[model samples]
Target: MNEEKMLKVEKIRRGTVIDHIPVGRAFKVLKILRISTDPGVTVSVAIHVKSKKMGLKDVVKIEDRILDSSELNKIALIAEGGTITIVEDYSVIKKFVVKLPDIITGILKCSNARCVSNMESAIKPSFTLLSKNPLSIKCHYCEREMETDEIMDSIL
Candidate 1:
Protein backbone atom coordinates (compact mmCIF):
# COMPACT_ATOMS: atom_id res chain seq x y z
CA MET A 1 0.00 0.00 0.00
CA ASN A 2 1.21 3.48 -0.80
CA GLU A 3 -0.14 6.72 0.63
CA GLU A 4 0.88 10.22 -0.24
CA LYS A 5 1.63 12.55 2.60
CA MET A 6 -0.70 15.45 2.99
CA LEU A 7 0.76 18.90 3.08
CA LYS A 8 -0.46 21.04 5.89
CA VAL A 9 0.69 24.23 7.53
CA GLU A 10 2.67 23.56 10.68
CA LYS A 11 2.19 25.44 13.88
CA ILE A 12 5.02 27.45 15.38
CA ARG A 13 5.88 26.65 18.97
CA ARG A 14 6.46 30.25 19.98
CA GLY A 15 6.69 33.23 17.73
CA THR A 16 4.92 35.97 15.87
CA VAL A 17 3.52 35.43 12.41
CA ILE A 18 2.49 38.34 10.25
CA ASP A 19 0.17 37.20 7.47
CA HIS A 20 -2.02 38.67 4.75
CA ILE A 21 0.79 40.95 3.62
CA PRO A 22 0.37 42.31 0.13
CA VAL A 23 2.06 40.20 -2.52
CA GLY A 24 5.61 41.37 -3.47
CA ARG A 25 5.91 43.25 -0.22
CA ALA A 26 7.19 40.44 1.99
CA PHE A 27 10.85 41.08 1.21
CA LYS A 28 10.30 44.77 1.65
CA VAL A 29 8.72 44.07 5.02
CA LEU A 30 11.76 42.04 5.97
CA LYS A 31 13.95 45.00 5.15
CA ILE A 32 11.77 47.42 7.07
CA LEU A 33 11.70 45.08 10.06
CA ARG A 34 15.50 44.99 9.97
CA ILE A 35 15.33 41.24 10.05
CA SER A 36 18.54 39.46 9.18
CA THR A 37 20.04 36.03 9.41
CA ASP A 38 20.61 36.56 13.11
CA PRO A 39 21.59 33.42 14.95
CA GLY A 40 19.54 34.41 17.96
CA VAL A 41 16.14 34.34 16.25
CA THR A 42 14.64 32.55 13.28
CA VAL A 43 12.93 34.55 10.57
CA SER A 44 10.99 33.02 7.73
CA VAL A 45 9.21 34.80 4.91
CA ALA A 46 7.13 33.67 1.95
CA ILE A 47 5.99 35.89 -0.90
CA HIS A 48 3.36 35.61 -3.61
CA VAL A 49 1.58 32.80 -1.84
CA LYS A 50 -2.12 32.34 -2.42
CA SER A 51 -4.34 34.08 0.07
CA LYS A 52 -8.11 34.24 0.31
CA LYS A 53 -8.24 37.97 0.87
CA MET A 54 -5.30 39.06 -1.22
CA GLY A 55 -5.46 36.16 -3.68
CA LEU A 56 -1.67 36.67 -3.46
CA LYS A 57 0.11 37.69 -0.28
CA ASP A 58 3.19 37.49 1.90
CA VAL A 59 3.79 35.74 5.17
CA VAL A 60 6.49 36.33 7.77
CA LYS A 61 7.21 33.63 10.33
CA ILE A 62 9.39 34.68 13.20
CA GLU A 63 10.57 32.56 16.09
CA ASP A 64 11.90 33.46 19.53
CA ARG A 65 11.21 37.16 19.12
CA ILE A 66 8.19 39.28 19.86
CA LEU A 67 7.73 42.68 18.29
CA ASP A 68 6.45 45.77 20.07
CA SER A 69 3.63 48.10 19.12
CA SER A 70 5.84 50.52 17.18
CA GLU A 71 7.20 47.80 14.96
CA LEU A 72 3.76 46.36 14.34
CA ASN A 73 2.47 49.80 13.43
CA LYS A 74 5.13 50.23 10.79
CA ILE A 75 4.39 46.80 9.44
CA ALA A 76 0.68 47.57 9.36
CA LEU A 77 1.28 50.31 6.83
CA ILE A 78 3.54 48.15 4.71
CA ALA A 79 1.32 45.13 4.98
CA GLU A 80 -1.87 47.06 4.95
CA GLY A 81 -4.89 44.89 5.81
CA GLY A 82 -2.61 42.20 7.18
CA THR A 83 -3.05 40.31 10.44
CA ILE A 84 -0.58 39.76 13.25
CA THR A 85 -0.78 36.54 15.20
CA ILE A 86 1.07 35.55 18.35
CA VAL A 87 1.41 31.82 18.73
CA GLU A 88 2.55 29.75 21.67
CA ASP A 89 2.42 25.98 22.17
CA TYR A 90 1.02 25.71 18.68
CA SER A 91 -2.12 27.63 19.62
CA VAL A 92 -3.02 31.19 18.73
CA ILE A 93 -2.67 33.33 21.83
CA LYS A 94 -3.56 36.64 20.29
CA LYS A 95 -4.89 37.86 16.99
CA PHE A 96 -4.56 41.49 16.08
CA VAL A 97 -5.96 43.15 12.99
CA VAL A 98 -3.57 45.54 11.33
CA LYS A 99 -5.36 48.70 10.40
CA LEU A 100 -4.48 51.77 8.41
CA PRO A 101 -3.50 54.57 10.73
CA ASP A 102 -5.26 57.86 10.19
CA ILE A 103 -1.97 59.60 10.74
CA ILE A 104 1.36 57.91 10.23
CA THR A 105 4.16 59.41 12.28
CA GLY A 106 7.94 59.19 11.89
CA ILE A 107 7.80 55.83 10.18
CA LEU A 108 8.14 56.94 6.58
CA LYS A 109 10.03 59.71 4.80
CA CYS A 110 8.75 62.03 2.12
CA SER A 111 9.36 60.99 -1.49
CA ASN A 112 9.94 64.57 -2.56
CA ALA A 113 13.38 64.77 -4.15
CA ARG A 114 14.24 67.88 -2.16
CA CYS A 115 12.74 66.93 1.18
CA VAL A 116 15.08 67.99 3.98
CA SER A 117 14.71 64.61 5.63
CA ASN A 118 16.55 63.18 2.66
CA MET A 119 19.58 65.40 3.18
CA GLU A 120 19.55 66.70 6.75
CA SER A 121 19.02 64.75 9.94
CA ALA A 122 17.46 67.84 11.45
CA ILE A 123 14.11 66.98 9.86
CA LYS A 124 12.07 63.93 10.63
CA PRO A 125 9.49 62.42 8.33
CA SER A 126 5.78 61.93 8.97
CA PHE A 127 2.53 61.53 7.01
CA THR A 128 -1.22 61.75 7.31
CA LEU A 129 -3.70 59.43 5.61
CA LEU A 130 -5.38 61.97 3.41
CA SER A 131 -7.83 59.83 1.47
CA LYS A 132 -8.66 56.21 1.34
CA ASN A 133 -10.13 57.24 -1.99
CA PRO A 134 -6.97 56.14 -3.69
CA LEU A 135 -5.26 54.98 -0.55
CA SER A 136 -3.01 58.02 -0.71
CA ILE A 137 -0.91 59.37 2.14
CA LYS A 138 0.51 62.90 2.36
CA CYS A 139 3.90 63.69 3.80
CA HIS A 140 3.66 65.99 6.75
CA TYR A 141 7.14 67.38 6.18
CA CYS A 142 7.35 68.03 2.43
CA GLU A 143 3.72 67.43 1.43
CA ARG A 144 4.84 64.66 -0.85
CA GLU A 145 2.37 62.34 -2.57
CA MET A 146 2.20 58.57 -2.32
CA GLU A 147 -0.08 55.58 -1.89
CA THR A 148 -0.08 53.07 0.96
CA ASP A 149 2.29 50.74 -0.87
CA GLU A 150 4.45 53.56 -2.18
CA ILE A 151 5.16 54.66 1.35
CA MET A 152 6.92 51.37 1.96
CA ASP A 153 9.34 52.02 -0.89
CA SER A 154 9.96 55.59 0.22
CA ILE A 155 10.94 54.41 3.68
CA LEU A 156 13.30 51.87 2.22
Candidate 2:
Protein backbone atom coordinates (compact mmCIF):
# COMPACT_ATOMS: atom_id res chain seq x y z
CA MET A 1 0.00 0.00 0.00
CA ASN A 2 1.20 3.50 -0.86
CA GLU A 3 0.94 6.62 1.30
CA GLU A 4 -1.89 7.89 -0.91
CA LYS A 5 -3.70 4.61 -0.48
CA MET A 6 -3.41 4.99 3.30
CA LEU A 7 -5.65 8.11 3.19
CA LYS A 8 -9.20 7.53 4.37
CA VAL A 9 -12.25 9.20 2.90
CA GLU A 10 -15.06 10.02 5.29
CA LYS A 11 -18.57 9.30 4.10
CA ILE A 12 -22.02 9.77 5.47
CA ARG A 13 -23.11 6.82 7.58
CA ARG A 14 -26.71 8.05 7.34
CA GLY A 15 -28.29 11.42 6.71
CA THR A 16 -29.96 13.80 4.27
CA VAL A 17 -28.34 15.91 1.60
CA ILE A 18 -30.23 19.04 0.61
CA ASP A 19 -28.77 20.15 -2.69
CA HIS A 20 -29.31 22.77 -5.39
CA ILE A 21 -30.08 25.51 -2.91
CA PRO A 22 -29.90 29.08 -4.10
CA VAL A 23 -26.49 30.69 -3.56
CA GLY A 24 -27.15 32.50 -0.30
CA ARG A 25 -29.62 30.33 1.60
CA ALA A 26 -27.40 27.51 2.80
CA PHE A 27 -26.77 29.14 6.16
CA LYS A 28 -30.42 30.08 6.36
CA VAL A 29 -31.19 26.40 6.04
CA LEU A 30 -28.78 25.75 8.87
CA LYS A 31 -30.53 28.31 11.04
CA ILE A 32 -33.84 26.68 10.25
CA LEU A 33 -32.38 23.24 10.90
CA ARG A 34 -31.25 24.50 14.28
CA ILE A 35 -28.40 22.04 14.31
CA SER A 36 -26.34 24.16 16.67
CA THR A 37 -29.10 23.95 19.21
CA ASP A 38 -29.01 20.17 19.12
CA PRO A 39 -26.19 17.82 19.91
CA GLY A 40 -25.55 14.49 18.12
CA VAL A 41 -26.57 16.26 14.90
CA THR A 42 -24.06 17.15 12.20
CA VAL A 43 -24.33 19.54 9.28
CA SER A 44 -22.04 20.63 6.46
CA VAL A 45 -22.63 23.24 3.79
CA ALA A 46 -21.16 24.36 0.44
CA ILE A 47 -22.08 27.59 -1.25
CA HIS A 48 -22.05 28.99 -4.82
CA VAL A 49 -21.41 25.87 -6.81
CA LYS A 50 -22.15 25.56 -10.49
CA SER A 51 -25.70 24.35 -11.13
CA LYS A 52 -28.25 24.18 -13.95
CA LYS A 53 -31.33 25.71 -12.30
CA MET A 54 -29.28 27.85 -10.02
CA GLY A 55 -26.16 29.13 -11.68
CA LEU A 56 -24.82 29.15 -8.15
CA LYS A 57 -26.06 27.26 -5.11
CA ASP A 58 -25.42 25.84 -1.68
CA VAL A 59 -25.75 22.35 -0.23
CA VAL A 60 -26.40 21.18 3.32
CA LYS A 61 -25.45 17.76 4.63
CA ILE A 62 -27.38 16.78 7.71
CA GLU A 63 -26.58 13.76 9.80
CA ASP A 64 -28.82 11.87 12.16
CA ARG A 65 -31.70 14.23 11.62
CA ILE A 66 -35.09 13.49 10.24
CA LEU A 67 -36.87 16.61 9.10
CA ASP A 68 -40.64 16.85 9.45
CA SER A 69 -43.00 17.99 6.69
CA SER A 70 -43.41 21.51 8.03
CA GLU A 71 -39.65 22.00 8.19
CA LEU A 72 -39.44 20.41 4.76
CA ASN A 73 -41.92 22.98 3.53
CA LYS A 74 -39.70 25.74 4.90
CA ILE A 75 -36.72 24.15 3.17
CA ALA A 76 -38.67 24.08 -0.08
CA LEU A 77 -39.20 27.80 0.20
CA ILE A 78 -35.56 28.77 0.65
CA ALA A 79 -33.99 26.12 -1.53
CA GLU A 80 -36.22 27.39 -4.30
CA GLY A 81 -36.50 24.24 -6.37
CA GLY A 82 -33.90 21.79 -5.14
CA THR A 83 -33.50 18.08 -4.55
CA ILE A 84 -33.20 16.17 -1.33
CA THR A 85 -31.36 12.87 -1.12
CA ILE A 86 -31.48 10.72 1.93
CA VAL A 87 -28.41 8.59 2.23
CA GLU A 88 -27.74 5.55 4.33
CA ASP A 89 -24.17 4.31 4.54
CA TYR A 90 -23.24 6.57 1.66
CA SER A 91 -25.92 5.10 -0.63
CA VAL A 92 -28.98 7.04 -1.64
CA ILE A 93 -32.09 5.56 -0.01
CA LYS A 94 -34.62 8.21 -0.92
CA LYS A 95 -35.02 11.18 -3.17
CA PHE A 96 -37.39 14.12 -2.81
CA VAL A 97 -38.28 17.01 -5.06
CA VAL A 98 -38.53 20.49 -3.61
CA LYS A 99 -41.36 22.55 -4.98
CA LEU A 100 -42.84 25.93 -4.19
CA PRO A 101 -46.00 25.45 -2.18
CA ASP A 102 -49.26 26.20 -3.96
CA ILE A 103 -50.50 27.96 -0.89
CA ILE A 104 -47.87 29.64 1.30
CA THR A 105 -49.41 30.83 4.54
CA GLY A 106 -47.61 32.50 7.43
CA ILE A 107 -44.34 31.07 6.13
CA LEU A 108 -43.31 34.20 4.33
CA LYS A 109 -43.78 37.74 5.58
CA CYS A 110 -45.34 40.15 3.16
CA SER A 111 -42.88 42.86 2.08
CA ASN A 112 -45.63 45.27 1.07
CA ALA A 113 -46.14 47.19 4.31
CA ARG A 114 -49.58 48.13 3.15
CA CYS A 115 -50.13 44.39 2.98
CA VAL A 116 -52.48 43.47 5.82
CA SER A 117 -50.33 40.69 7.28
CA ASN A 118 -47.75 43.34 8.14
CA MET A 119 -50.37 45.37 9.89
CA GLU A 120 -52.36 42.81 11.83
CA SER A 121 -51.02 39.98 13.93
CA ALA A 122 -54.51 38.62 14.48
CA ILE A 123 -54.78 37.80 10.79
CA LYS A 124 -52.69 34.86 9.74
CA PRO A 125 -50.81 35.51 6.52
CA SER A 126 -51.36 33.59 3.29
CA PHE A 127 -50.36 33.73 -0.34
CA THR A 128 -51.42 31.68 -3.33
CA LEU A 129 -49.18 31.11 -6.28
CA LEU A 130 -50.89 32.62 -9.29
CA SER A 131 -48.71 30.81 -11.73
CA LYS A 132 -45.87 28.35 -11.92
CA ASN A 133 -45.95 30.06 -15.30
CA PRO A 134 -43.65 32.79 -14.04
CA LEU A 135 -43.20 31.98 -10.34
CA SER A 136 -45.59 34.56 -9.00
CA ILE A 137 -48.06 34.60 -6.12
CA LYS A 138 -50.84 36.71 -4.69
CA CYS A 139 -50.89 37.71 -1.04
CA HIS A 140 -54.20 36.51 0.38
CA TYR A 141 -54.16 38.80 3.37
CA CYS A 142 -53.09 41.92 1.51
CA GLU A 143 -54.30 41.23 -2.00
CA ARG A 144 -50.89 42.18 -3.32
CA GLU A 145 -49.01 40.43 -6.10
CA MET A 146 -45.58 39.07 -5.14
CA GLU A 147 -43.11 37.56 -7.49
CA THR A 148 -40.49 34.96 -6.55
CA ASP A 149 -37.75 37.56 -6.65
CA GLU A 150 -39.69 39.80 -4.33
CA ILE A 151 -40.44 36.91 -2.02
CA MET A 152 -36.77 35.99 -1.99
CA ASP A 153 -35.81 39.48 -0.94
CA SER A 154 -38.66 40.06 1.44
CA ILE A 155 -38.10 40.68 5.16
CA LEU A 156 -39.52 37.26 5.91
Candidate 3:
Protein backbone atom coordinates (compact mmCIF):
# COMPACT_ATOMS: atom_id res chain seq x y z
CA MET A 1 0.00 0.00 0.00
CA ASN A 2 2.78 2.47 0.87
CA GLU A 3 4.64 1.51 -2.28
CA GLU A 4 1.55 2.26 -4.32
CA LYS A 5 1.19 5.63 -2.61
CA MET A 6 4.83 6.43 -3.21
CA LEU A 7 4.41 5.74 -6.90
CA LYS A 8 2.14 8.77 -7.25
CA VAL A 9 5.25 10.88 -7.53
CA GLU A 10 7.18 9.25 -10.31
CA LYS A 11 10.94 8.92 -9.99
CA ILE A 12 12.98 11.82 -11.32
CA ARG A 13 15.38 11.43 -14.17
CA ARG A 14 17.85 13.74 -12.43
CA GLY A 15 18.10 15.97 -9.36
CA THR A 16 18.03 15.72 -5.57
CA VAL A 17 15.96 13.70 -3.11
CA ILE A 18 16.09 14.74 0.52
CA ASP A 19 14.66 12.11 2.80
CA HIS A 20 14.20 11.54 6.53
CA ILE A 21 13.75 15.20 7.40
CA PRO A 22 12.31 15.56 10.88
CA VAL A 23 8.54 15.68 10.88
CA GLY A 24 6.89 18.98 9.88
CA ARG A 25 10.15 20.49 8.59
CA ALA A 26 9.59 19.97 4.89
CA PHE A 27 8.43 23.59 4.47
CA LYS A 28 11.38 24.88 6.44
CA VAL A 29 13.65 22.82 4.24
CA LEU A 30 12.02 24.40 1.21
CA LYS A 31 12.53 27.81 2.79
CA ILE A 32 16.20 27.05 3.45
CA LEU A 33 16.57 26.03 -0.17
CA ARG A 34 14.63 29.11 -1.30
CA ILE A 35 12.55 26.95 -3.58
CA SER A 36 9.87 29.02 -5.24
CA THR A 37 6.81 28.16 -7.27
CA ASP A 38 8.78 28.87 -10.40
CA PRO A 39 7.68 27.03 -13.52
CA GLY A 40 10.94 25.30 -14.26
CA VAL A 41 11.29 23.75 -10.81
CA THR A 42 9.28 20.68 -9.92
CA VAL A 43 9.26 20.23 -6.16
CA SER A 44 7.34 17.56 -4.26
CA VAL A 45 6.95 17.65 -0.50
CA ALA A 46 5.73 14.81 1.72
CA ILE A 47 5.21 15.48 5.39
CA HIS A 48 4.44 13.25 8.38
CA VAL A 49 4.92 10.12 6.37
CA LYS A 50 5.69 6.82 7.96
CA SER A 51 9.25 5.62 7.63
CA LYS A 52 10.63 2.36 8.93
CA LYS A 53 13.76 4.15 10.00
CA MET A 54 12.36 7.53 11.01
CA GLY A 55 8.86 6.45 12.12
CA LEU A 56 7.38 9.73 10.89
CA LYS A 57 9.36 12.14 8.75
CA ASP A 58 9.26 14.42 5.72
CA VAL A 59 10.67 14.07 2.24
CA VAL A 60 11.38 16.58 -0.50
CA LYS A 61 12.13 15.90 -4.14
CA ILE A 62 13.27 18.65 -6.44
CA GLU A 63 13.55 17.84 -10.13
CA ASP A 64 16.21 19.31 -12.34
CA ARG A 65 17.85 21.05 -9.39
CA ILE A 66 21.11 20.25 -7.67
CA LEU A 67 22.06 21.92 -4.43
CA ASP A 68 25.52 23.29 -3.70
CA SER A 69 27.65 22.66 -0.61
CA SER A 70 26.61 25.85 1.15
CA GLU A 71 22.95 25.02 0.71
CA LEU A 72 23.68 21.51 1.96
CA ASN A 73 25.33 23.04 5.00
CA LYS A 74 22.21 25.06 5.72
CA ILE A 75 20.21 21.88 5.44
CA ALA A 76 22.58 20.17 7.85
CA LEU A 77 21.91 22.95 10.33
CA ILE A 78 18.19 22.43 10.01
CA ALA A 79 17.79 18.71 9.40
CA GLU A 80 20.74 17.19 11.16
CA GLY A 81 19.80 13.57 10.60
CA GLY A 82 18.43 13.83 7.12
CA THR A 83 19.84 11.96 4.13
CA ILE A 84 20.50 13.52 0.74
CA THR A 85 20.48 11.48 -2.45
CA ILE A 86 21.73 12.79 -5.74
CA VAL A 87 20.02 11.07 -8.63
CA GLU A 88 20.73 10.89 -12.37
CA ASP A 89 19.07 8.74 -15.02
CA TYR A 90 16.64 7.67 -12.30
CA SER A 91 19.48 6.07 -10.39
CA VAL A 92 21.06 7.04 -7.11
CA ILE A 93 24.40 8.64 -7.97
CA LYS A 94 25.34 9.69 -4.47
CA LYS A 95 23.73 9.34 -1.05
CA PHE A 96 24.88 10.48 2.36
CA VAL A 97 23.83 11.96 5.67
CA VAL A 98 24.22 15.70 6.19
CA LYS A 99 27.12 16.77 8.35
CA LEU A 100 27.41 20.16 10.04
CA PRO A 101 30.59 22.08 9.52
CA ASP A 102 32.97 22.83 12.39
CA ILE A 103 32.69 26.49 11.54
CA ILE A 104 29.54 27.75 9.88
CA THR A 105 29.87 30.96 7.86
CA GLY A 106 27.57 33.50 6.26
CA ILE A 107 24.54 31.21 5.96
CA LEU A 108 22.97 32.34 9.20
CA LYS A 109 22.89 35.76 10.81
CA CYS A 110 24.23 36.39 14.26
CA SER A 111 21.46 36.26 16.87
CA ASN A 112 23.01 39.18 18.69
CA ALA A 113 21.59 42.39 17.29
CA ARG A 114 24.66 44.23 18.55
CA CYS A 115 27.11 41.83 16.92
CA VAL A 116 29.53 43.38 14.45
CA SER A 117 28.18 41.25 11.64
CA ASN A 118 24.71 42.56 12.36
CA MET A 119 25.77 46.16 12.84
CA GLU A 120 28.00 47.48 10.10
CA SER A 121 30.61 46.74 7.48
CA ALA A 122 30.33 43.48 5.62
CA ILE A 123 31.43 41.14 8.36
CA LYS A 124 29.77 37.92 7.26
CA PRO A 125 28.18 36.12 10.14
CA SER A 126 30.25 33.17 11.31
CA PHE A 127 29.68 30.73 14.16
CA THR A 128 31.92 28.29 15.93
CA LEU A 129 30.33 24.99 16.86
CA LEU A 130 29.85 24.69 20.58
CA SER A 131 28.14 21.32 20.47
CA LYS A 132 27.05 18.86 17.81
CA ASN A 133 24.49 16.50 19.36
CA PRO A 134 22.19 19.27 20.53
CA LEU A 135 23.85 21.70 18.16
CA SER A 136 24.94 25.03 19.61
CA ILE A 137 26.96 27.83 18.05
CA LYS A 138 28.68 31.02 19.14
CA CYS A 139 29.15 34.03 16.94
CA HIS A 140 32.80 34.30 15.94
CA TYR A 141 32.73 38.07 16.00
CA CYS A 142 30.75 38.73 19.18
CA GLU A 143 30.89 35.52 21.21
CA ARG A 144 27.11 35.40 21.32
CA GLU A 145 25.91 31.87 21.96
CA MET A 146 22.96 30.45 20.08
CA GLU A 147 21.42 27.03 20.38
CA THR A 148 19.86 25.02 17.57
CA ASP A 149 16.50 26.70 17.94
CA GLU A 150 17.99 30.19 18.12
CA ILE A 151 20.28 29.62 15.17
CA MET A 152 17.43 28.01 13.20
CA ASP A 153 15.45 31.20 13.69
CA SER A 154 18.45 33.27 12.52
CA ILE A 155 18.88 31.69 9.12
CA LEU A 156 19.55 34.31 6.42
- Report the number of the highest-lDDT candidate: 3
* Residue 93, model 1, lDDT: 91
Which of the two, 2 or 3, has more lDDT?
A: 3
Model 2 ranges off by over 4 Å: 1-10, 52-55, 111-123, 131-136, 147-156
Against the correct fold, how does model 3 do in TM-score?
Answer: 0.88
Per-residue lDDT of 117 in model 3: 90
Give the number of the best model, judged by TM-score. 3
How much does each candidate deviate from the true structure in C-alpha RMSD? 4.3, 5.3, 2.2
Clashes of each: 0, 0, 0
lDDT of 2 by residue, 12-130 (tens): 67888788777888887887667778888877776776665667878788887767776787787667577887788778788888887889876678878887688878987788878
- Candidate 2 global CA lDDT score: 0.73
State the lDDT of candidate 3 residue by residue for 51-153, as single tens digits.
Answer: 8887899999999998899889999997887999999999989999998888999799998888889887667788998887778888999999899778778
RMSD in angstroms between candidate 3 and the native structure over all alpha carbons: 2.2
Better TM-score candidate (2, 3): 3
Ordered from best to worst lDDT, the candidate numbers read 3, 1, 2
- Descending-TM-score candidate ranking: 3, 1, 2
- Tell me the spans in candidate 1 whose CA falls farther than 4 Å from its real position: 1-8, 116-124, 132-134, 148-150
Report the Cα lDDT for residue 48, model 2.
Answer: 70
Candidate 1 lDDT over residue span 54-156, tens digit each: 6787788888777787788788777767888898888889989888689877777788879777888876677888775457888777788798667767764
Residue pairs clashing, model 1: none
